[model samples]
Target: MKKIIFSSYLKLKSAPLAFMFALLFVAASCDTQDDVQPDSRALVSDNITAALKNNNWSAPGNSSAKERKPTFNTLLVALAKTGLTSTVAKEELTLFAPSDEAFAALGLYPNNIGNVPNLEQILLYHAVQGELYASDLSAGFVPTLNGAAVEVTLNGGVQVNGADVILADKRALNGVIHVIDEVLMPPTLNLVELALSFNPEFTILVAAVQKANLVNTLANDGPFTVFAPTNDAFVALLNELGFPNLDAVPDETLRDILLYHVVPGRIYSSDLSTGDVTAANEDTFYVNTSNLTITDANGREANLVPSLLNVQATNGVVHVIDRVILPELGN
Candidate 1:
């Protein structure tokens, strides 16, 4: 638990070099766009000033910070509290700046920053070392300063850890900034606790797990891979089983079904191939890479939805499946 105590942000005085560079930047723009460095190094050296500007550093559009001062305030205050303001202001970094609405969506208020446990970890999770412009990113795991990795998917557009990159390639003098619409949460909870964090979607699944008394087993200490089913998926299961709800299923039967959805090790979406992986139920599950599908023991197949894939947890990984996996009773 890293406690972040707030302090006043010591302003760095502007240097002649910064003004000289800003003038040079305008002059360079008259030539060709390719001639200029495609990052924040082209802007004023005073990052604190650059971040507060209305227009983005390099991006040719309105800036997120300009639109939502409060969100920027939240982020900047966190950096100042952690004493990382100078590091971001002077060093090379790539920050995924979340929008004001993003923090609101996560139920994070301006006052919540100091009270949140591992507050520094959450802020550091958004930053990566070196200058990474939007064009420099590729679809894979990006290691962050928080010592955990965030997955970047480039199928439709840029997405980091399921958060859509609303605005990309905003340059800052000290680093680069990309505006994201969702907060990239760090893996602070175990599988069970993490699942509970997303209420309503996994409400039925949570209830079933609790009823089975498998909370400890799932949350104990695991590098487990889980194929979690959403609420709709559980409803489908109840209908198929002729039950009114999850509670109507026998405890042993419910436990077996839930166990069937879990794999005993960390398996990410990128690691999938056409092969057989054993589930926690000791039953074989088939993985098909060509179509990105997972097949259960009962011959039921669940396609891995891109939007719901590769959710990281402190103890392991979780992927949301469209359907609930049921094990063959005899097997």
Candidate 2:
């Protein structure tokens, strides 16, 4: 099982950035590992039963759930838990509703929303101060309700923060809703915090980083580009290597593998070119821009899934890959 401490790794500090972007990043870097601060912003409920009771719950009056046909059941539940449902339902705002799969890709299960320290900030980040239709959106940063600016890319099928806008312009009496394929995370968290905050899906990776003692290197003074793999990817690697779990792998071997995923600068998906780039381990991987895939020395290829690209953390960026690329481990 994943450790609870891992989830709280990033909740150790707080800042009043209303949006918790760069401000949060500065605060986080100053925080010590032992100084875990309390976050008053988190919804004080862990499950629907607790949320319904604590949140002054009221059902949506207009059956927008039926008309929107509950297209965002997960999002609605999250709004309700944060007690922002009524505000969203009655106010004039634009909401970017993340699909269930979007949340999953980010390692956030719907049930765990309440446990997150920055729930309010995260939910607010998805909303704009006023209504914005697809036509109104331009390719640039737009202010969100959380007080941060999110990049809107009109180049390829309409992407917000590198996430494709799967469904657009779903009219709500209160506002317009755009369904996104990936969750948009604020730039408050560093790569380590981002991975540690979202667990189970990233437990293996997080554990590896911790075990390798690469946390401080990633957390401080870096705009490193990291190619993170999902827990499934790690599992497949363990099975292939004949290891039951990460612990069975040698520390040196694990550290090298972890380093292999990192590049020493901030390289966003948009900036990727077709060719070979050196990993932190000094190994090379072939990047094919045509399909956005990376091929390792062993000829194993991992596709950079569209739903998990260009996740910007405060100190660096994280790109999710479908497989763990192994370096040439010499005997």
Candidate 3:
């Protein structure tokens, strides 16, 4: 429900630098709200029957292989529908396979969702370009075949974009399959667009961005991580700076401060650690994941809101913070 469009970091050991999108800081259910009520299980069963006809359908596993519950019935349908079943069976790629329940959360089943826009792209968002096992997964931004990146988190347990990996390192003919809990929908907007979409929540943040003339910069194909402050945070900043409103703040100063909130990569909450994270302003801020707080160069600390973390956008990632990070002014 917190719609500030922000990003953060938790752990980053080392991995391939693939980028995904920044999130629009809304709850997942809100993002998946559609007109149609969830389709019945009978429809899902029908899709599975149709998908079974695709001989290329080898994921979840061949019957001769390890005998499991075949939980990926819906995923199998998606892959078969896209002719991606053959690809998953033959290609050396990694798939974060979501279960039927994951798709059900979006009111999607194989047959019912055949008309969904960009179905192929949505399926591709769940895959990477190479065969990566759980061991190969380091916490960082990993580019998916969809041309966007997915966030990998190894902090407590392995999580992809925020979906828990209930099962990991399931081998495929050409790649690995990791069963995940949620279906990750690709981000549709960039940082600025995402913020503006939330209206009054980011009204002040969006204003500061426009006044600073950073709309285009933030909207560009950046894989940037923005530790966005809430509207309340901006108000608190105005009180701290003894200013009545954002208009009283100088442009250069606002720009500098805003820039300080942005880091140059797609850092997820899992990638954050206890260290100095340099911002886009060429200044650095300290993050302590232990306390979930960011300390700017001025030694002032801002807490990352626990619930509003790791929202993805088309060009970047976003983490909603409770305070507006400050950068030193007047040298």
Give TM per candidate. Answer: 0.52, 0.48, 0.65
Put down candidate 2 lDDT per residue, 204-303, tens digits, no spaces.
8998999999989998867798999999999999998899889999999999999999998778776789999999989999999899899998999998
- Candidate 1 clashing pairs, residues 3+ apart or interchain: none
| Whole-model Cα lDDT of every candidate shown, in order | 0.76, 0.75, 0.77
- Residue 326 miss distance in model 1 (angstroms): 6.7
True-vs-predicted CA distance for residue 328, candidate 3, Å: 2.2
Distance from true position, residue 225, model 3, in Å?
A: 0.4
Residues 148-180, candidate 1, lDDT per residue (tens digit)?
Answer: 578888968899988888777666766778888
**Candidate 3 runs further than 4 Å off:** 1-91, 98-114, 134-143, 147-170, 179-183
Report the lDDT tens digits of candidate 3 across residue range 166-218.
76765544555677889888887889998988688889999999999999999
TM-score of 1: 0.52
Off by over 4 Å in 1: 1-74, 83-93, 98-118, 129-132, 139-190, 193-213, 229-260, 264-271, 278-284, 290-292, 297-317, 321-331
Task: At residue 169, give the lDDT of candidate 3.
Answer: 65
Best by lDDT: 3
TM-score of 3: 0.65
